[model samples]
Target chain A: MLYIALKMLMADRAKYTGLLLGIAFTAFLVTFAAAYFSGFMTRGFALIAENGAADVWVMDAAVESVEQTINMPDSALDRIRGVEGVRYAVPLALGTVDARFPNGRFQTFQVIGVDDATLAGAPVLKDGGVPTVLRAPDAAIIDDGGTSGKLLTPVLKTDQWPHDGAHLEAAIRELAVGDELLANDQRIKVVGRSETLPRFPPRPLIYTTFANAARILPQERHLLTFVLATAEPGLSPNDLAQRIHARTGLRARASEDFKTDTVRWYLVNSEDVGDMAAMLILAMSVGFGVTGVLLYIFTYENLKQYAVLNAMGATPRVLLSMIFAQTGICALTGTGLGLGACVLVGEITAKAGYPFRMMWFTPLLGTVGVLIVSLTAAAISARPVLKLQPAVVFAGR
Target chain B: MSTDANHEIAVRCQGVTKTYGTGVAQVAALRGIDLDVRQGELLMLVGPSGCGKTTLISIIAAILDKDGGQCKVLGHDLEQMSQNDRVRFRGKSIGFVFQVFNLLPSLTALENVAIPLLLNGVPRGRAEERVRSALDSVGLGERMNAYPAQLSGGQQQRVAIARALVHNPKLIVCDEPTSNLDHKTGQDMMDILRGVAQSPDRALIIVTHDPRILGFADRIAYMDDGRITDIIAGKHRGQLQ
Candidate 1:
């Protein structure tokens, strides 16, 4: 009977294809929305999220999230280092500087200064090397997602530039090793290219040693933005943060707690995050509506066959199982196709410099949405079958 | 009085009554129907449109409930059985052939014929074997893999009959089994049905208005205004015709 059900469903090629397309389109929309939202949320706290080695972060008492933090005095790192249960503490300086390219193009760049001795906060270099090259005078490492939002070598756009002088976001080049640029009127040379976590509304990221950052950045009383710390082996990060807070009188948080705080702040204050979440809900609602209605129409069109089966002595349970099997095939296939397409698109967008972070949980969440669509469709489609009278088969031949 | 021939009765109905709708819209489809179908019998029910011929057969098949009556098929009271048991009994012991040759259009003739056996929980391999033999019995052996739309009207009807008989049900009920066929095709369908109706332990009932196939019935019951007005032996009726 299940085979019969499948045969009956497959007999009408147009309807079956229409049903599959309906499910696939819905799944794709849901997956795209979820992946985009996941990407946006992850980028909201890129600095905190990317530095997985740090167990705790100490900043000014008023700082709520990484993006909204105020600069703290450089002495805060030394005080945090002296706290009990602290393994090591390093000063991190993050500031925006006006960078003047050799072509005289001026763009704002976010300059991050990690500890000169440890270089603990620098991103991993694309060439599988450390940022030790930043140890050289007036040298810095820029992320691959810099300047042109791509890793192209720095060059003036002319007859020789790729894409017919049209700068493609994909073809734009980051500042490469030995490329000189002016920051805050100080000349600096790119020493290496590193791959860093992406940021929304992407800006060029440049890393330098603490002493160099102070030179490239405008002078100020407080030069450090955050104090990255590691907890002792036996102490939990939360406990160590509490100890740091009690001793230094500055706000402190575990890495995970800070990440959560960042995301929470965005959720509360950023309309973009709220709008993206609402868009996700809208996509799911549309998916449910379209898939459910299409499935219902498909079932309604085949009601006569169901009546024939019922008149042939199939129990309601048997008929329901057949319907479920049909729905399962559609749901599983659509989910696989939609998710596969999402992954492929994620790859394309990531390569093209679009913020598209697809964690494992995003697709898992999309699958749950698809399942809801399937169950809703099955439940809605089953009503007509349940109410069908087998005697309808005897009507008008 | 009807002659029993000392054979066991497959279907017995007494004072069966059925009504459609409710209130002023209510129309009584059956006032009272009392009939007995015996084993080894091929009974033809002939009647005018809306005369309750189909209603009576549907009730006998346990697909519809009667307002008041005692209807027993193969010694089990249909009214006393629960819905699940009725479904089980129908799956295990009864078969139905529809006028439209209600073979699932997507399935080949072989797969269509295997539906009843599958519904009854027969393993797929055995079910396919039985389906092949059933289609072969109806002279459709070469067209086993042909879809319904690919087959002619007569061939489709034959597939329907094979489906009806594949589970070896003790009773088979057909509604307008040959109404869609042309003169020769109708007769051919009747011939095939008559061949399968010879099983001594099973019975067949065909509800139809087509008079050309009357000779194939072992007994004919004429219905008018929801009552059986006549019962005649097939041999005697053939002589009169």
Candidate 2:
């Protein structure tokens, strides 16, 4: 009888295809929205993700997220290093500077300054250069995102000279080990290129030493952006963070907790979440509207056949099973197709540097949503079937 | 077509009454009806349109409830059984043929014939074997794989009959089985139905208005205005009324 039910559903190819498309569209929209949100959240904390060696990050009490930092005083690092469970603490400076490329193009680059001796927060370089490369005069490492993107310079020296008005099209090349840029009228050299995770809002990165950053940036009373610390062997990062906060009256968080805080801050402040939620709601509405109405029509049209089955000894339970079986098939197949499509699109968008990630939970969420749509459709359609009078089969007589 | 005194009664109805709708729209369809159907017999109920033949048969088949009546089918009182029990009893003991044939268009003749057996919890392989034999008995063995639309009107009717008999139910009820056919096809259908009634433990009740198939009945009951006006033996068919 379940086999027969499938046959009956497939007999009307138009309606069957309509139902599948409706469910598939819903799954696709829901999954795409979730994946987009996940991608944005991952990128929101990309800096913390790349600096994996740090167990805790200490900042001013007013700081909320890594992106919105309030620079701490230089004495904060010494205060944190003096705590009982702290192994060591290093100073980290974060600031944005106007960098003039060899092609006479100017762009704002995010500058990260690590400790001069340890270079604890330095990103891994593509050529495996030692961190001692930053010790050279006016040396810096350009991140891969910058070399391939905003830092592209003309290959010809003639094109490197500044023009008066509009920019000219020329053959260009990525910044290499010897490429030079000017920061605040000071000449800086790119000693290496590092591969780091792409950031939200997609700013290019420049890594240099703490002493070099002080020279490149304007003098200020508080230039230390954060204090990176490691915990002792026996102490957990959370416990160390709590101790640092208690002793210094500064904001301190475990590395993982800081990442989560960064993501939560963006979710609360940005409009992206509301937009994604609206898209999800619209997808669910379309799913319910189209699938529900079509299923109801399909059942209503076949009421006579159901009546014959009823008269032939099919109990109401049997009839309900057949209906659910039909809807379940639609739900499973539609969810598979939709999830497959989302993964394919994710691969493409990831290559193009768009924020799109298909996490495991995203697909699971889509499957649950599609199942609800199918169950609602089955319930709405089964009402008329259960209420049909078998004697109606003999009505024309 | 004859019934012996020892043959068990398949259906017993007394003072069966049924009404449709309520309030100002109320209309009585069956009023104070008494009838008995015995095994090894073919009974025909003839009547005008809206004369309650369908209503009474619906009550006897346990698909509809009677307003006030004592209706017993296959030795079980239908009014006293729970809905699930009544449905199970009807599935195991009764078969039905509708006026429109009511064949699911998507299924092949073989699958259509296997429905009753499947509903009775028969395994697929065994049900297919029984369905093949049933279709063969109805002279549709060659066209068992054809869909309903692919078969002609007479062929579809034969498939419906095979479906009715596939589960080997003790009682078969048909409503206007031959009215949609030509005279030759109608007579052929009657011949097939008469052959089915030859079993000593099986009974058939047909409600129809066609006069050409009257000779196939063992007894005919004439109904009009929601009541049975007269009944006569098949040998005295000319004395209807």
Candidate 3:
């Protein structure tokens, strides 16, 4: 009987194909949306991820996330270092500075300042150079993320501009170790390129010594954005953070807790989250909507066959089982194809620098969602079949 | 199948009554139908349109419930059986052939013929073996793999008949079995149905309006306005004409 049910469903080629594609499309869209969301959330805490050596981050009491920071006075760092369980503390500064590229084009770059002596929180350079390379005079390390886009510099010198009314067609290339830029009218050399995790709303990144950053940027009264600290051996980071918060009277979070806080802040404040949610809801509506209508039509068209079977002594339970079998087959096949397509697309997009991550839960959620759609379709298709009177087979006579 | 010297009653209906719809739209389809079908007999219920022939057969097949009456098919009281019990009983004891052939268009003739046996919990391999023999009996063995749309009207009706007989149920009910076929094809269908009724433990009930196939029945019950009008032997076809 189940075999017959399958045959009946597959006999109508158009409806069968429509149903498969509808479910597969739904699965694909749902999974892609979820993976994109996961990728964005990961990027939301990317800075915290790159600064892996920091056990705890102490900030102003009103600062909630790393992205939105309130600079503490220089004295805050001293107070944090003086707290119990704090092995040592370093000042980390974050601010934006407009840099003039070689082509005379200006772009704003996110500048991160690490401690001058220990060079804590510096990203690993791509060329295998140590962080001590930043110790060079007026030196900065440009992150690889911005090298190909915003920081791309023309090979031609500024004086070599084609002034004869001819197209210059400047041969531009990524900024590298020997390139130079101007920030606040001060000359800075790019010492190396570091491979840091990409950031949300991707921006060019510049890393320099703390003292060099103060000299290159405009003067300010409160220059310290955060105090990065490490815990002593055998002492937990959470305990150190608690001690720092108590003594400094500021917000202190373990590294992992800070990452969570940053992600939570984005979830609450970012419009991008709402856009992703709307896309997910739209996918579900379209996927379930098309599949449900097609399935209902298929069942309605076969009502005569069901009546015949019913008259031939098929119980309601048997008939219901047949509908479920049909729905289950569609769900499994469609979801498998959808998830496979998602992984393939995710691979391509990730290479193209798109925010897409396929976590283990992404496919699981897709399968579960498709199963729900299939079950709803089955329930709706089963109603007319269950209520069908076998006598209907004799009606037209 | 051997004949029994003492004839056994296959279906007995007493004061069976049924109604359809409600309020101003209420209509009576069966008014106290009292009829009996004997084992090894082919009984045809002949009636005009809107008469109770279909309603009576539906009740006997256990597909429809009667508003009032005592009805027993194959010695079991239908009113006494629970819904599940009735379904199981119908699956085990009754078979049906419908007008327009009602064969599932997607299934091959052999698979369609195997439905009743499958419904009775017969394993597929065992059921297919019996289905082959049943199709062979209907002279449709060569067309077993053909879908209904691929076969002629006569062939499709033969497949429906084979389906009706595949499980070897005690009672077989057919509604308008020959109405959709031409003269020669209709006669052929009647011949296949007559052969199935020869089994001594089984009885056949056919609800039809076609008078051309009147000679094939052992008895014909005439119905008018939801009431049984007359019962005449099939040999007295001249009287009906």
Candidate 4:
């Protein structure tokens, strides 16, 4: 009976194709939006992930995330270094400064200052390992994707640069080594280039010694933004963070915990998070709406065949099984196609430097959503079939 | 079982009444039908449109519920049995043929014929073998793999008959079995149905309006307004017309 049901479903070519397409489109929307959202979250926490050597980060008590920087007294770094479980502690300074290119193109770049002696928090250099160039006078290292490529392009009257991630990447890549730029009237030279993870709204990223950073900006009594720390042998990062928090009277977070905190902060504070969530919900609605209507019409059109089966002494269970089998075929096939489309789109956007991360759970989430759509459609469509009288086969020819 | 009063009767209906709707819209399909179809006989119920031939057969086939009646099929009281039990009884004991040859268009003739046996829980291999033999008996062996759309009307009707006989049910009911076919095709269909559907313990009932195939019936029951007005011997061989 199931075999016959399948054959009957396959016989109507137009309806079958329409149903499959509807299901596939729904699956595609769900998976694509989820992957995009995952990509956004990964970018949101890039600062924590990029500083691989740091096991703990000590910040001001009021600071919730890396994006929300709160300056701490420079004395906090030394206090954290004296904690029992700490192996070593280094100062990290994060501040944005205005840079004017030699071509008079003015832009703002994120300046990260590492420990002057150890270069402990510096981005890994592209070719020159561990960047000794920062020791030079008035020297700074720029990201390979950061400067002298498209970032230095003068802002056009008509706004030639489209405000998107790809355009931002092109802007970052405009700067190069051996170029001198100005930060707040202080002359600085790009001495090296390095590769690093991209953050959201790609900025011109500059790395320099803490001393040079201090000299370029106005002097202040409290200069440290965060203190990056490592755990001693046999001590977990969480334990080291707790010790630092206790000793220094500052908020200390394990690196992993800091990443979670950053993501949570963005969720609560950013409109982008809400926008991505809305897109995901809309995808799910489209999936259910399109697939449900198509499946219902297909089943309704084939009611007569079902009636024949009913009259032939098929129980409700048998008929239900047949409908379920049809749903399974459409649901599984649609999910596979949708996921495949997501992977294809993920590749294309990634090449264009767009943020899109398809995790295992995203596809799993998509499959569940598609299954719900198919089953709900089947339940709605099966009502008429369950009530069909076999005697309908005896009606007008 | 041998001493039961309806032992030799394939179907027995007494005071069976079926109404389509209620109140002002009420249409009584069967006023009070009393019918008995005996074993080893092909009974033809002949009537015009709206005369309740199809309704009476539907009640006998256990596919429709009568408003009030005592309807027994092969000693099983249809109204007394639960819906599930009645469906089970119908699956294992009865077969049906329709004038339009209600073959599933998606299936080949062989698969269509195998449906009844499969519904009765026969394994696929054995059911298919029986289906093949039944089609062969109806002289449709060469066209077993052909879909109904690809076959002629006469050939399609033969496949329907083959399906009816494949499960070896005790009774087979056909409605308007020859109404869609031309004279020669209709005659050919009747020949196949009458030749393959008669046995000592099995019975066949056909409800139709065509008189050209009357010669194939063992007895013809003429109906008018849901009542059996006359029953006469058919023009079957060695029987009075």
Clash pairs, model 3 backbone: none
Which regions of candidate 3 deviate over 4 angstroms?
A: A73-89, A100-105, A125-131, A144-148, A152-156, A159-180, A184-186, A216-219, A231-250, A395-397, B1-8, B236-241
lDDT of 4 at A44: 80
Off by over 4 Å in 4: A12-18, A103-105, A126-130, A144-150, A153-173, A215-221, A246-249, B1-7, B236-241
Worst 10 residues of 4 chain A by lDDT: A164-173
As a whole number from 0 to 100, the lDDT of residue B9 in candidate 4 is: 81
lDDT string, candidate 2, A33-81, tens digits = 7888788788878888878888999999988787888688788888999
Tell me the tens digit of each residue's lDDT in model 1 across A1-397: 7777777778888888888777777777787777777777777788887778899999999988877768987788889999999999888998888886654556778889999999988877888887788899998898744235433344554412244443333323556677777899998888888778877546778889989999999888888899999998999999999999999999999998998898888889888788878877887888778888888888888888888888777889988998888888878887788788888888898788666778777788778888887878888889889888787888652
TM-score of 3: 0.88
DockQ of 4: 0.61
Model number with the top DockQ: 2
- After TM-score superposition, the amount by which residue A169's alpha carbon in candidate 2 deviates from its true location, in angstroms, is 10
What is the alpha-carbon lDDT for the whole of candidate 2?
Answer: 0.84
Per-residue CA lDDT of model 3 for A1-397, tens digit only, reads: 8999999989978888878887788788788878988888788788888888889999999988877887899999888888878888899998888987766677888889999999998877998888898999999998844235676777766522245432235677778888888998888899999888888867888899998888777778887998999999988999989888887789999999999998898878778777777877887778768767766777788888888888788888999998889888888888888888999999998888777989889888888988887888889889999988788888563
TM-score, candidate 4, is: 0.89
DockQ of 3: 0.65
Model 4, B1-241: lDDT tens per residue? Answer: 0112333788888888888878999988888888777887788999888889888888898888889978888998887898888777777788888877889998999999988888889999999899989999999999999999999998999999999889899999999888899999898888887778878788888998898888898778888887888877676624311
